[model samples]
Target: MSQEKPPVPSGRRRGGLLPNARDIKAWEEGGGRGLRGFLRRTIRAYLRWNRALLLDPWIRYRPAVQLLEGQTGDLQRTLDVGSGENGLARFLGREVVGVDLDFPATVRWSNHPATLLRAIRATATALPFRDGAFDTVVSMDMIEHLPTGERPKALREMLRVARRTAIVGFPYGRRSREFDRSALAVERDRGIELGWRQEHVLRGTPGEEFHDEIIRTVGAVRPEMTLSWFGHEGMRGLRLRWRLQFLISKDSRLYGLVFFPLYRLHSRGRPKHGYRRIYVFKKAAGGKPGDRVRRPARNSVRDPD
Candidate 1:
């Protein structure tokens, strides 16, 4: 008799490592399929948003929509550091460039060049590009993967390379040395590190020293900037439009059927608690070039008691 699959725990998100051999095989084959799926879904979403914008005039200045539109601007040259899979790179105009630690040469970008250069491997402390090599540089949701000590250096390099704009996106909730406390406990108890030998466990609390550090680093570089936050519903609304397009058009059978809704709904967004934080910075145009300001001598300044 065949064995029944175990039930996924209630409230545990789907695709969180509980899959059969068949599922794994399917996913491995579906990696390329998934990328195409997201591209289709995102394009569909853009169309949907376009419709909604036409229908509802009030949303013309919505922060989320505004941010999405901001990503579509004409950039002569862009460097997407830590660009995983180059999704955003596709949206950039013809002059864009991409660099990543893991992308292989086999990876293709028809419009522009995508280079595989590990930020860490190239020189974790210094970037490989000449000064002001790009009009825009973006690092999306990438800083947390770095060692805590190295993040500031990376941010500085990002600032140094961009001529006009630099944006960095990451989870906003907290900056903790131990971002996943319970997960670490599980790893230690199991005597397995998953892949890495160690992992962070403690969540960074609000008003922590790290927040000040990030503010200092980014503020010194891009003093005039904006912050945008997106929740699960916000992302879902974007993806639902994409799904509608796939359903209506039925362009690619495999893509329309399995990939469209799968990406539309599942790729919706992270948990409510795990929403992403986006920071957008535009370099000052012939603006004041002031001296580099160092962060305070202490992690954070304290008022006298």
Candidate 2:
């Protein structure tokens, strides 16, 4: 039987920032043939179990909690822009309304019961909320999915609605390129070996460009808005893990036994290049409601991670 193409969201021709319906459909249809298919499914299940058991709680959730420590201000009400399955609402422990183009259906297969309860369907460029509606706004791993030109608009909208602060995090600099390269390599190798190709559609924006645009956008809102930046995760270590994770997932049970410990040890350390960059913007003191701040001529100094 021929595979049916996944339907795109109404009024939108292409997929959103993250993996969309089409990507999920492709993944579902791309299991290997005969013995290969059975082995692939078995391995995938083990990997999924590992991710749910260890990776999510330790690698992702813990880091996010650590990143937000001493950073979140006035968490009374918050907005999570481009929130996918694992919404920030889970972490904040306060009122956090999540908005995304995909929202409740972003994950495709499984329902995010908790996230759906508070998530609304909306786009980052045009958030459906009143000015200063949220005390703090947070967006993670979402901005780079947009075209370079649209990122500023999204950042501006986040700032416009934030009464006190806005926090944004994304892969940065050489790290972004390395991720894309490793991902593409894995996909290419999989297609050659299993006759299933997974296409990555989004373009990556350099940290420098993203950083500059963010600075300009925030400055335009409140020229005196204090911007603090934090960088984390060594770039080389991240690249190595990305490659190893893909290779190990093929025979997860056997390789995982060996890979897991080395993965933990290798992931430790500081490097000259950072994989992720987090930006926190605070409204300037004595700034009125509608003040327009001019963009600074040079980039600001970096803060410790």
Candidate 3:
């Protein structure tokens, strides 16, 4: 079977400052004195702020946010399990309750206000909410953080709390395994380790075996809900991004200088083969995984590399 391409959101125009330097320069090219200059700076500040929150973590996970925010729509009561220091709630721009083990002590200096605003001290394996407490539940790039035995448990907790939809994303399947292993080797050679990638090394990304297991679990336990999945960020894309990561690693001060432009260069693209898979399990009002849920609005983007 052929894998599907990444789904684009409906009515998304993606307006803001353009990613290139010439555009930025043109925008700044006038009115240096008086109120107009002040206005220019203010607008620049606002645009920068938006870019920071939305385009940041731009390398690996921006797609997850774009996908989640688009599909969930205007839901108010969403839960993000394993929400980490800065969860999807920050980008979703709504009232989402975030639960994580270490959120309480996470520093607020670099965090957006939304990250800490509704964050709770809890675990994905044991969510505190009653059944159907949220309209949507999302756990992105976090499932692999758990041990093999606990991955399903975390997923179950998300499903248990979600009244309508539960979205889970992780680095899994065969291609993802190869991607991370190569990334680890490249990072190790530089003697610089990305903390999260190290965990991916230790815990190991799941492959086809666990894939079948999850399908069986959902099929047997939540027959009313439906499951669908697709892959994103193929090997070529992953390698290019991984190499870019090393360009600024040796100097903390130079990271932003080098990263921002490359970030713009690599902001959004179609993946040919998905190194990571996103599994969306949605529940219809009175049906199972066999029931049809609205699919995300899709465009003719290429399949993962």
Best by lDDT: 3
Question: Across residues 1-305, which tens digit of lDDT does each residue of candidate 3 receive?
Answer: 99997653233334543234443444455447677577567556644554454234343455555655555444567887877656665556555677878755653524455343477888788999999898778777887888889987887777788877777777776677777787788778878667888888889887766777777777766678877776555666556756775554523333455556655665456443466667777775567345433233462232222
TM-score of each: 0.48, 0.63, 0.70
Of 1 and 3, the candidate ahead on lDDT is 3
Model 2 C-alpha lDDT per residue in residues 1-305, reported as the tens digit of each score = 99999876454357455333454334445597797476557555755654443432133333444545565446557788876656665554444688887744444213234432367888899999998898778887777777777888898898889888787876677555656666666666766432211211246644676666776777667565777665546666656766676666633444555556655664454333566566777777776433433323343454222
Off by over 4 Å in 3: 1-74, 104-116, 249-272, 288-305
Clash number for every model? 5, 1, 16
**Which 10 consecutive residues of model 3 have the lowest summed lDDT?**
296-305
TM-score of 2: 0.63
Instruction: Report the alpha-carbon TM-score of model 3 versus the true structure.
Output: 0.70
lDDT of residue 265 for candidate 1: 50
> For model 2, what is the C-alpha lDDT against the true structure?
0.62
189-222 per-residue lDDT for model 1 (tens digits) = 8574643214222223222344457568756765
Descending-TM-score candidate ranking: 3, 2, 1
Best by TM-score: 3
Give candidate 1's whole-model lDDT.
0.48
